[model samples]
Target: MSGPAAALSASPAGTGPDQVRGPVITGWSAVSPYGIGRDAFVQGVSSGRATVSVLDTERWPGPDELACLVPDFDVREVLGKKGTRSMDRVSGLAVTAVRELIAESEGAGLPAGGEEVALVLGTTTGSAQSMMDITRDTLIHEKPFYIDPSHIPNALMNCAAGQCAIWYGLKGPNTTVAGGRASGLLALNYARRLLTAGRAHTILCGAAEEYSPARSWLERHTRHPDENATVLGEGCAVLRLQPPGTHPHPLAELLCITTAITHPHHITTTLAHTIKRALHQTRLNPHDIWAVSPSTPPGTTADHERHALDLIFTDHTPHHIPAPGPIGDTAAATATFQITTLLSHHQQHPQPPNRIALITAIDRDGVLATALLRLL
Candidate 1:
C-alpha cells in the first residue's frame, strides 16, 4: 500500500493520556517452533521456510498430523527443577516467555513490585492434556478423589495466566480470555482497557498454545473435514505494553483495537465494517497502511477474510500477509504472531517512522478483531 505516511497525533479516548499519546510496545519475547526468544522467531518466519513437521504418531497416538513445536524447550532451564515440577505445558510456555521479556527489559527497570504490573493472557481450551489426564483418572477409578491433587489447578481454563502471576509475583489484576483464534486481540483490548482505567502501570500481555498428545488427538477428531483446514501449531509471544507516552523508546504505538461478533451470513460485511472502524478510530486512511496481516488460517474463514479485504481496499492492494501458511495455525497466538511479523518487517526494512500496519483476525467462534499499529 502507498500513501502519505501520517504520524500519530492524539491518544485514544478513555486512556487518560495527559498529552496526545498512544500505548507503546516497549519489549517482547517469544517461544515458537523456531526456538526460544524473539530473534529465533523473527529469523524463522523471515526465512520463509515452513516450520511445521510431521508429529510423532506413536507418542501422540493421533492420525497423521503436523505441528509447529518449540524445539528442545525445557522449563527447568528457565524455572529450575522445583518450580517446573507442578507446571503444565501451557504454564511452562507462559512462564518462559514472560521471563524472556523481563530479561530483555533489564536496564529499563520495569515495575518490580507485585501490584505494579498486570498479567493478561489469552488461551483456547487451556491445558487440555492435564484436564484429560485427571478426567480419565477419575472416570476409570470410579472415584472423584482418585484424580491427582497436583493436576487440579491445571484443569482450569485460566491456569496459564494464573500460574504466570504466581511465578512472576504479579499481584495486579490477572485475567485469561478464551477467544479461540481471536484471543490475542481480545487480550490486547483488555490490556488497553486496564490502562485506560489506570488499573496498572504496565501490562504483560500475550497468548500461548501447547502441542501435546491430547490436543493433537482432539484436533484430529473434531476438526472439520475441509481439505484446507489449518494445521495445529504451538507457540507463545508476550509483549510489554505501557500507557502512551510512558516509554521513551517504544517499538510501536498501538492506535486502536476493534472487535465484533458476526455470523456466517454477514461475516464479510461485518469484517469490512470492523476494519473500517479501526481505520476511522485511528484517523487513518486505507493508503496509510504499510501492510496488513490476516489471521485467517484457511477454508471458509480465509475466503471470508479475503472478501472483506477486497471490499475495504479495492484498488490498492496492501502488502497483505497470510500468517497460517508460514507458521501453521497457532489458534490463540495467531494475532500475536501477526503483530510480531509486522514488527519484524519494520525492524528489517526500517520503515519511515510512524508508518502504520493493520492486524486482523477472525476466531473460530466468529469474533472479528482488528488492531492498528504504527512503527516508532
Candidate 2:
C-alpha cells in the first residue's frame, strides 16, 4: 500500500466532506509501440528510449519507411489462435487493451464485468487497410460484388468497439467516437456524460490506432507539403472510469474536459480560450497545474498549441510532458497516451496531493480539446 493504492486511501490535508469530486480513474492499461501493457509504456517513456523501427517493405510498403509499431504484435499469436483469422489490427489492439484493463480492474478488488459497465472507444477510422482491401477485392473479382464476408466487419468504423463489447460481453452502452487526434478526449467526455446521465456505473474508455500502408499513404497525401513528416505510431490505451468516491484506490480525479472548434486561422486564440474556460470551471488557477501534456505532432499546429499554452501560463510554467517525441504521432491515441504518461510519471515522482495535470489536444480539422486531472 505504499504506492498509488496507499495514496488513494489516505485523505489529503485540505480535503473534507465538502470537497467537490469528479470521475475517478481507478485503473488503466496500454498496448503501445514500446511494447504492451502499462509497465512497458511507463518504462519506455521513463527510459526515454526510441521505439521507432525500420519497416519491412514486403509486408507494409508505404510512403513512410519508419514507424513506431507495437513490436512483435501478431493478432493470432498475441490474442491466441481462436477467432482471430479475420480480425483486423485495430480490433485486435482494442480487444487486447480491454482484456488487460479488465484484468487490472479485477486485480484491484473490483468487478471486471457486469451489466452496468460500458465501453467507449475512439478512432479516426477503424482500419484503413481493411476497408481498402475489401474495396479492391470487390472490383477485381469475377463478380463485382464478390468479397470476403469475414473482412466486412473490420471495414466499419465501429468494428473495434463492437469487437470489444462482443469479446467482453459488455451489456451497457457501447459507443464509437471519431474526431481524429481529438478522439481520445471526445471519448472521455462521452464517458463522463454517460456517468452523469446514470447510464452506467463504470466505463472503459480509450482510443486505438493501427499502423498500415493504407493509413500511411492517406496521412502522406493529407498532410501539408511544407510540414515535415513525423514517424506514425499506433497502439491503444484504456482507462477504467468510475464515479467519484466509488473507488477507494483512485489514481486521479478528472475535473473537466472542454473542447472547441474554430477556423484554422483562429486556432491559437480559440485553444487559449478553451484552456482558460476549463481552468475557470474547475476553480483552479494556472499555478495549480503541476504538469502539462500537449499533443504536439509537428509544424503549424504544434506552434499554435505552444502559443496557446504560453498565453495562459505566463507566470507559472508547468513541467512539460511531451507525447510525440517518444511515442511518435499516435493520431487518435495521442490524448489517451498523454493521460497515461501523466499517470506513469506520477507513479515514479509521486506528486503532492491535489496537484493538477493538464492535457490539450488539437486536430487538423479545427478541433481543440482540453482536460484537467487532479492527482490523488
Candidate 3:
C-alpha cells in the first residue's frame, strides 16, 4: 500500500454544468481481524503491530500461508441463532457491520426505517464456501435440487447486501458490485450517485470479504507467487453516507469519485488516469492532498500501483499509507478499510480543517477507482 508514486496524464476535461455534489460520510463501522469494533482496528493499525497469522493447517491444508482472520467471530452471538443458522460468514459480517453502523448513528439524522435507506456493497467473489457446497451437491447428489435449502440464499453475490437489508430493514434500494479489489470504491460511487440523484436520502455503502479454505485455495492457484503479495484477510466495513447539508457534523465530505475500466495489462496507466480524473473533477491540486490510502494487492500489481502514485504526486510527498499491510489483502473490503483508516488517522492526529485525502484501488479485472475526500 505504501510506496513511491507516479503522475497521471493531463487533467480530465471539465464536464461543464449540472454536476451533482458529493455525499458526506456521517458514520462508519468496521469488523476486522484486529477485533470486533472500529476502536480495536484503529488501535491495532496505529500501534503498528502485525496482525497476520497462519490459518489452521489441518482445516486449511496447503502451502505455508499467512492471513488476517477475524478472531472468534460468531454471528449467533450477535444476531441470535434462529436467522443466523443459514447465514454464511460474509453475510453475517455484512449484517453485523451494518448494524453497528446504524447503532452508532442512532440519533445522527439517519433514516428512520428500511424504506428510507439504501444499501450498496462490494465483493471480489460471493461466498466461496457456499458456492462450493452448492456445486458439490449439484454434481454428487443423485436427485435434482439436492443442495441444502439453507445454502441457496447465500450463494448469490448480492446476498450480503440483501441479507443486510432484511436484517436491518433497509428497503429503499439494494445493490451489489463485483469490482474485485475496487469493489469498495465502486459501491461508494454508486451510493453517492444515489444520493446525488435524490434516489435515496441515505445509503449504506461498503465492502466485505471472508477468509475461508475455499478462498485460500483459489488464491493459491490464481494469485502470483511474489513474496510482496499480501496475505489474504477478511472483514466487513460499512459507511453511512448522506447528502451534504444533511448531517450537522459529518466525519468527512466525499468530494469526488472516478473509475476507469481497461484491460488487465493496462492497470497501472488506467489507475493513474482514474486518480487524475478524480482530482480534476474535484478541482484539487495534488499538493492539496494531505494523505493517500492505496489499495495495493500483492505482486506486480503492487509495483504498478506504487509507480502510478509516484507519478501522481511528483511535487509534494503526501503521507503514503498502505491499508493492506496490517490487515492483509481484504479483497473488496480493502478500499473501505482504506477510507476508514484515513478517518482514523485524522481522529488521532486532528488535522487542520478542510485537509484533503485521496483513496485509490485497482482490481484484477482492471477496474481502477479513486475517491477524493476533504476532512472537516
Best by TM-score: 2
lDDT of each candidate versus the true structure: 0.80, 0.86, 0.81
Clashes of 1: 0
Q: In terms of TM-score, how similar is model 3 to the real structure? A: 0.91
Worst 10 residues of 1 by lDDT: 1-10
Better of 2 and 3 by TM-score: 2
RMSD of every candidate to native, in Å, equals: 4.9, 4.6, 6.3
- Candidates in order, TM-scores: namely 0.92, 0.94, 0.91
lDDT of candidate 3 over 1-376, digit per residue (tens) = 1111111111222321122134678889899988877788778768877778877888666554788888878779867997888889999899988888888888888878767799999998789988987888898989858878978988999998899998878889899998888899999988877775667878999999998888877877877667335578899989988865577777777777888889878787788888887777767778788888988777777788888898888888998766847777888899999998888888888876677788988877688898887777
Best first by lDDT, ranked: 2, 3, 1
lDDT tens digits by residue: candidate 2, 129-193: 99999999988999977998999999999999999989888989999999989999999999988
Sort the candidates on TM-score, descending order.
2, 1, 3
lDDT-wise, the better of 1 and 3 is 3
Question: Ten-residue segment with the worst summed lDDT in candidate 3?
Answer: 1-10
